[model samples]
Target chain A: MLRFANPTLFLKLVRWLLPLAGGAGAVLLAWGLYLVFAVSPEDYQQGATVRIMYIHVPAAWLALSCYSLMALSSIGSLVWKHPLADVSAKALAPIGAAFTFLCLVTGALWGKPMWGTWWVWDARLTSVLVLFLVYCGIMALWTAFDDPARAARPVAILTLFGFINVPIVKFSVDWWNTLHQPASVFRMGGPSIDPSMLTPLFVMASGATALMLALHLAGMRTEIMRRRVRTLSQQLARQDGGS
Target chain B: MMDTPHAGYILASYLLAGVIVAGLVLLAVLDDRAQRKALARLEAQGLRRRSSGQTGEQ
Candidate 1:
């Protein structure tokens, strides 16, 4: 992993990995969508509305996972001073924010049909909202400084601080009385859902994970190039000043 | 797939997710391309990046 701290090595790795990740994501998502819309039987209670689970659950899961990745990268940046760690953290912020936004929107869509309201101020929903706001704040903090290098420490510290929200978001329903349902798929007894439903959920989740991986590589590639551009321009400025 | 009692909500959720995910992918691709292009342009201007191991032909 530390060997990948070299930008050239990282770039070479991503060049091939991006296409592989993208292709796998496409195939899995296609298969997952087919299973979701065509094969999985409707819930007797929720009917067709339950199909929304395919998108909502994966979005929510990925949202949390992305934040976890960012926090880990933050630690890497602060402790190891890993070259690419800050780039990874910076790159993940918007992707995580986007996923968090999707989770909220899809949850609202699911909530309206099943719970008779678009939203409720319950522990689960409220904590996820807080997580989303933290995502936004983190992103804002990334650009809050002119020098990206100077921005790194604050961003890392804030990310570490903000990580408290992740567990809160995950266990809120279980810990408190809420309109949201308790964990069905990841509880102590294991997933209580039918195999048919569980299969598509995993497939869709794999696809989403692959997609995030592809985007993450692309984002890091962009950052590396952007850093090069900044360096080159700064060198040119210094040369001009000296001349 | 669109004839159910709450099909609209389900469809909307999927559609929104699709749009957001696609938009993110598109943005990442475009940003990568733009940066590469800028770097190439800088190289073309005889400005070689130090330590990138590129021999820039002026």
Candidate 2:
């Protein structure tokens, strides 16, 4: 982990990792989609609409997981002041926001057909919505500062503070009466979902995780270059002024 | 599956997810290209980074 703190080494590593992750993601997603349509059976209660769970559940999972990654990166930024950690936290914000948006829209699409509505102000739904807003806020905070370094601490602080919503979003269904279902795939008693559906769901999730990693790696690489550009331009300006 | 009731909703969900994911991929790729271009232009102007000795191309 500490070795990766060096930006040059990180860039070299991502050069290979990005393609590997992207290729794996493409393959897994294709395989997962095939299983979703061909192998998984329709739910007795929800019928064809249950198919939405493959995409929706994975989006929700990734959204939460992305936030968790950001929060961990934020800790690295604040506690250790690691350079790559700051880049990671910055890079992940938009990706996390995108996934959260996917989760909400897909959840609404699933809800309308099955639950007879587009949305409900339930604990789970509302908390996820808050999570989306927090992502947006963190992105906004990033742009608010003129210097990326100046932005790092504030963004890290906001991220750590916003992490309160992650567990709330996860456990919201259990803690409150909500339209959202509680812990089907992950529960103390083991998965309530049948094996037929669970297989494709896990495949889709693994695919999504791979894709997210690819995007993060690319984002980090870009951010490192961006900082380099800033530094080079400043140096050029200084040389001109001194001349 | 297309004949299934509420298929439009399911299709819409998948379509939207595809669009968002593609958009993210596009953004990452474009940003990377742009930064690389900027760095190259600066380096071409003979303004090397102070730490250029320790690092390769940005």
Candidate 3:
């Protein structure tokens, strides 16, 4: 892993991997959407509206996963001073935030019909809401300081602190009596949902994850370039003043 | 118009997701290009200054 720490080496690897990741993501997304629209069975209880889960659940899971990833990477940045780690965390924030927002909105959409309300204070929902706020706080911290390192320090610490909430969000349904449904797909036995629905759900979940990775890597590349430009511009100004 | 029970909810949700994802991707690409250009320009300026500095010293 550290062998590719050199920026130029990393860039070359990213260049080769980008097209592959992006293309696979596109194909998976297309197939996933096709299955979602045409092949997957509607819920016996919820009817056509269950289709929203194709996008909603995946976004929710990805949002939480992305935050956990950012927190882990932030630890590396703060402790080991791994250059790419901080870049990865910084770049992933907006995309993760967007996913979290979608999860909340879509979950609300699903809830209004299924539960007869637009919003609820269920443990799962409330925890996810806190997760979103945590993301927002990290983003705000990133810009609150003029010194880049200082700005990053608080975010890193916050990320590490906030990760404790992820597990609570994940298991809130099981841990506490809640409106949210218990785990169906990830259980000791197997998915309780019919295979007809599970297939497309898996496809869409994979596609969404690939899409997340593609967006994240692309964003990370841009951040690397951005920092490079910032450093270079400062050097140029310094040289000009020196002479 | 597709008011089949909860169709409006599903449609709205999908639309929002699409808009957000597409907007983010476009912004990422734009930022990448902008940063690369800025770095190129700065490097060029630095090169010019270093060359001028050498001449002044001689």
DockQ scores for all predicted structures: 0.59, 0.79, 0.36
C-alpha lDDT (0 to 100) for residue A186 of candidate 1: 91
Ranking 1 against 2 by lDDT, winner: 2
Q: Which ten residues in a row have the lowest lDDT in candidate 1 chain A?
A: A1-10
Query: How big is the positional error of residue A141 in model 1, measured in Å on the Cα after superposition?
Result: 0.9
| Model 3 misplacement above 4 A | B1-3, B47-58
Candidates 2 and 3: which is better by DockQ?
Answer: 2
User: Please, what are the lDDT tens digits per residue for candidate 2 over residues B1-58?
Assistant: 5558889988898899899989999988788889888888887887776665754544
Q: Residue by residue across A124-214, what tens digits does model 2's lDDT show?
A: 9999999999999999999999899999999999999999999999999899999999989888899999999999999999999999999
Colliding pairs, model 2: none
Would candidate 3 be rated incorrect, acceptable, medium or high by CAPRI criteria? acceptable
User: For model 3, how does the per-residue alpha-carbon lDDT over A1-243 read when each residue is reduced to its tens digit?
Assistant: 787675556776788677788788789889988888878877778898989988888998899889988988898889998878888898788888999999999999999999999888999999989989988988888888765656677788889999999999989999999988888888888889888888888888888888888888888778777766666667777778999
User: What shift in Å separates residue A86 of candidate 2 from its native position after superposition?
Assistant: 0.8
* DockQ, candidate 2, vs. native dimer: 0.79
Q: Across residues A138-213, which tens digit of lDDT does each residue of candidate 1 receive? A: 9999889877888999999999999999999999998899999999999998999999999999999999999998
- Candidate 1 Cα misplacement greater than 4 A, ranges: B55-58
**Candidate 2 chain B lDDT trough over 10 residues, lowest sum:** B49-58
Lowest summed lDDT across 10 adjacent residues in model 3 chain A is found at A3-12
